[model samples]
Target: MPESRKAAAAMSKTGQTEPSAPATETSAAMGGSQASPKKVSQTGAAVEKIRSRIIDLTIPPGSRIDEPLLLKEFQLGRTPAREAINQLAAEGFVKILPNRGGTFVRKLDLAEIGEIVVAHQLVENNLAQLCRLDDETLADDLERIQTVYRVEVDNRRYLNITELNEQFHMRMNQSIGNSFFHDFAQSTHRHVRRLLVHLYTLESALPEQQDEQFELNVRQHDRIIEAVRDKDREALTEVLPEHAGATQDRLVRLLQSNTVAPFPVKLRPLVLPGN
Candidate 1:
């Protein structure tokens, strides 16, 4: 984007995000933990574990999140649990209701998916196109990132694969030297990571199918990385939409399937309320 255009776009989305809520006190504050290796709750480890659980879909979208149960299960104190839940809410994983308690991660319906694609395309692609990557060393870093994602694909587990995928894209955004889009893209992508993982989690897949899919994803990353390395705007532009389209289709189907469950809080019929 031209200098003026980038500024305008940034200004327009300035008010889109809000700060997350504060967390309650952790239980460990009362008594220190004794469990060494397996035990968590050292220092925000609870938070990290909860975050990981969400990414891994151990706790699927719409799954009920009872605080006390979580506390007992994770062996965390009130403060840490509160903080983790608050952070999860902030990250768009769980919805904290006034009286009903916290719910599990939320799904990206058609509308949210549309919003993501539009946001990614506008901010990410534009910044990428405008990026000046004359530095070959940066290309090396990208190649390393691509390598990591390849491993992630091979693993086919929800947690690490999706996390690495997000990191890969975030690194690409960061490389552009545009802090505004870089940060926004990272945060925006965070909210959608759970479903993205659900979309591609390896479930009863044949070796051949998994290998081909992983190969395609790796090649896609390579193409994008190469474009960035060469500062080829056309290649960057051509690859992103194509990549997102396949991703969108995959995600939509994944959400529609049973591989990654959507934890629908208080499941009910399809009746429109108050109809």
Candidate 2:
């Protein structure tokens, strides 16, 4: 009921977060902490805060999480904070260390990244094959989304463009009316977005290069829209792979170079061939 708690709850729903509150008595329990039923909403907010940081690479990959510091930062009680960390651990972004105190963000593994990309491409390819985006109402919906994307593109709002791109993909999957595939696609996209954020953070990937890629991505979306309009499966397949392949290669190249952002823990890139 407190103002801070209310704000936290709102942030949880939007997956946006603020700086963690300074540590208090609430910071005591971390690993084995237990939150009460009443604190569930606050716990969720804490989780969102953590997740947002992870996605933005603010909580860099392979970084050791400081429970007390996080507790202080989020101004959350022990139970809620620990629960949030545990949830992240369950989501595979954080690893719970029984021997070591607190949790750690998982290191980026090139092999795992490749698997995620390939799986995403297959799922999307299948969705494109089955989706009837040519339906008048559905086409209108996609057109509207694409309109917003174009606005972002013209304004050079690169980050907003990324979000719009994800929205476009999510909408495409949702239009299929398959709840299972929709949920799977959502998870895959989340990982893909995080990878993109990580890639953007690297020194080797200059801002101009990222801008060029964004332009290319927008053009590809234009092609995909045309493909959907014409109901051309082959065109859809081609454009979709091209879109994903560029990111895949950029990710691999970032892994191959020695330009990783600093973190408390050292994460060696899983050296896979074809880099």
Candidate 3:
């Protein structure tokens, strides 16, 4: 059997079934107009498990991705294992190095967090301004997403919280009716979500404070929804920065509290020429 087929068989034995391939690929494989679910492919399964570990910091930032171990753990063959790594690299979750440096989880940069926040805020604000509130359904969609977000926050499901939060923002961005802005907002929102994964994980240690902060986020989402519903550009412009800054502020507090000693990634101070 082919390597991919062998990998698929191995994965099926382990119960980690692969997701269906895209419709185009399925149709082409079947050699007919009708498309059916493809057999479990180990590649997608490996990618998802590895990506989740990286995001949840289970793999830890900057840690080498062990291919042999992954193959054994996920019951993936060589081809599928490498394919999963390449897919992760494409998603910016893993870094591939030349000259046999080996692939590593992408490190979270302290300095880049601030820049990401700025970019996210800029994109979100612009998208909000451009959004057409003529569609009442847009506000309804946002409210629906916000409801789920609040539940995730209250439940302390960090991963779910970040994912739902991203959905909430992206739903708003979708109203802009401009693909360019929507895409830009998507990329920025993803960066923020990844960064928030770390922030939320660290905050998890402090139950009282974590609950308070999460409630604040819930309230902010509510405010954003109200702004969108009322078509209040000014309110959105003001609240959006406050919402973005909340994450930055929490990160600062986490660092200052000395609770995150040794930090997950390296930290370096920026130096200017004169200084």
Candidate 4:
């Protein structure tokens, strides 16, 4: 089966809903009644912290997850710590090995990254094509998200920028009202979040370049809004690839730069579109 179909089937069995935030499993874990509210809150906090570290590359890819260190660092009980790891594993940020091989942070190699980019483009383009332009509120909702995304960009909050970007595209996908596509898009966004983090991190040292790239993103988003409002499928098709391609271009350039440190996982040559 295709990976997206497999993910859809898994989500069906798991009953995962569209996530407003990057760490949807945290919310799911918090909503469970097996733990006290305080413990649940702690678990949620731990999950967010750990997940953020992983995304930001602080935890590094493929490193063994230290449960005891997490408990001590987060001041979490054993149960809460375990719960947090379980949630992260489910969310694809962590890999839980069988037979006590120990859990590790998931690694992204060049091949996996290529597949993710392809899947991302497929799902996002499909969503844009199928979206109901006459939904009346679709443009308005996207405008609201873009507003917040602009703020995060201006504030240089890379993490918030990534989260809002996901929310922006997810809102578009949601407007199509297809649960299967929504779930697949949500999964792709989840995987893309970490890559965006790396992209933003690479640009962190170059304020001028970063600002220029972010401004371009804002304008692309505006064009997307305009396309939606005007019911212009041609404009949507033209702009969506450009917007996605910008990130791909930046990542390829950054990876090829000598100043950047090596990734924990071995990165083979990246073959993006037009490369």
lDDT measured at residue 267 in model 4 versus the true structure, 0 to 100? 36
> Going through the candidates in order, what is the number of backbone clashes in each?
9, 8, 0, 0
**TM-scores of all predicted structures:** 0.67, 0.69, 0.74, 0.76
- Model 1 residue runs over 4 Å out of place are 1-43, 108-114, 202-211, 251-275
- How much lDDT does candidate 3 score? 0.68
Between candidates 1 and 2, the one scoring higher on TM-score is 2
The digit string of per-residue lDDT tens for model 1 on 206-262 reads: 446445556777788888888887778788778865665555555444445555555
Clashes of 2: 8
Q: Deviation in angstroms for 2 in model 1?
A: 40
Backbone clash pairs for candidate 3 read: none
After superposition, candidate 2 runs with Cα above 4 Å error: 1-41, 150-159, 203-208, 252-275
Least lDDT summed over 10 consecutive residues: which range in candidate 3?
17-26
**Model 3 alpha-carbon miss at residue 256, Å:** 3.1
Report the C-alpha lDDT of model 4 over 223-266, residue by residue, as the tens digit: 99999989898898888877876767766667566557755554
Q: In angstroms, how far off is 224's CA in candidate 1?
A: 1.5
C-alpha lDDT of residue 243 in model 3: 86
Residue-level lDDT of model 3, residues 110-139, one tens digit each, is 666766767775775566567676768877
Best by TM-score: 4
